[model samples]
Target: MGCSNNWCELYGSHTSLCGCFVAIVLHGNKYITNHKGQTKPTVLLDCLAQWGIEKIFCIIVDNATANTCALRKFQSSFSLLSNEAFVMDGEFMHIRCAAHITNLIVNDGLAEVDENVSTIRNAVGYVRSSTPRLRSFELWIDSGKLTRGNFPLDVKTRWNSTYLMLSKALEFRLAFDKMEAEDMLYNDYFMEFEGGAQDGGRGHDCYNPEESDGVE
Candidate 1:
């Protein structure tokens, strides 16, 4: 179970091949009014009833306070019914999402290098801002004797995208330096980021290959 922007997404997973392979299926989605613990359990129960699903081995949810409350309520309600509804009387019914846990840890570690990551993110955004700028950047890459590849922009919510963005950008580090030296637009592009209100007055230098090491 996961709620984002007042929408709750429920997924169902079952073990196949005698508990060897796990198959995940999307059960349903509902537009939630809020993230209240009470609301979530009720919504899940309603979905289960609609699906005619009575027995569930476990429920995996992200680490959230509301999920804790929802699990407690769900378990209590299930306990009222027959014990066959759970594999072990709901002893191991609540499972925390491992991917979410890892994402949380990675995001925490990346916080220390947030500014450095932001610089590269903004640099990529600059080049991708328009077709003309992209052409100029490609020219720089060609002149610098660097192989050109698609520069993937990172999605802030996913740390893996940031890693890809930085790794790919490193290939064209020399090209960025070349742009800073030769392209006036490229040089001025970063000036707006320096001491800007949006960035909380954190001054940024023009993207430098040397600074890429900080993020690495």
Candidate 2:
């Protein structure tokens, strides 16, 4: 009843601070296959039946079309089981995940500044690629009296990681500029990007330490 892909379902309880109900435990966590909308309701239904739960207040999910489909299927199937399966006739049962929505918003905004982010990502990658290069970068940081911190490489899919990498990289911008001038490897490293640093080459702005700093 499962496929190659792994899917997880989590259920938690929330109560008001003044409520006497305490020690709420998670009752739903299941491994399934193909978590698309069509398959999601079936699995979730099975879980509800197993746990003997008949009423649902809400189902929080990301803004994926599959989730929307899943919710529709769940509502219809659950209603067949019991007329009172959902609070308020399931009108407010589908709650879009706020964190996921914020992530989407941030990623959309980041798309407008892809080049600048890429430039900084590449610079951070270059510096942290090797121990010698990192030591040289540290030397530059020390010379410039900048705070030394761990360089973070960002995952393209995660905006929070990108934000952290950019924030940390900003602390050593002068060191990056110094490395661009004093370090031959750093200079040549950028030179290899999308042809040399000539007119219309990607290396033109990507090679500059201040390129990512322009992002606001």
Quick one: best lDDT, which candidate?
2
Residue 10 local lDDT, model 2: 39
Per-residue lDDT tens digits for candidate 2, residues 58-80, read: 77776778788888997898899
Which prediction has the highest TM-score against the true structure?
2
Global lDDT of each model? 0.64, 0.65
Off by over 4 Å in 2: 1-29, 143-149, 194-216
lDDT of 1 by residue, 1-216 (tens): 233312223345432100101112223454345667777667666656665666666677777787889779977886666667776666777877777788788889888877877877888887877777887888877644222247788888788887788877776778777877888876666666455534421113434556556456
lDDT of 1 at 190: 64
Q: Number of clashing residue pairs in every model?
A: 0, 0
- Give the backbone clash total of model 2: 0
The C-alpha local distance difference test score for the whole of candidate 2 amounts to 0.65
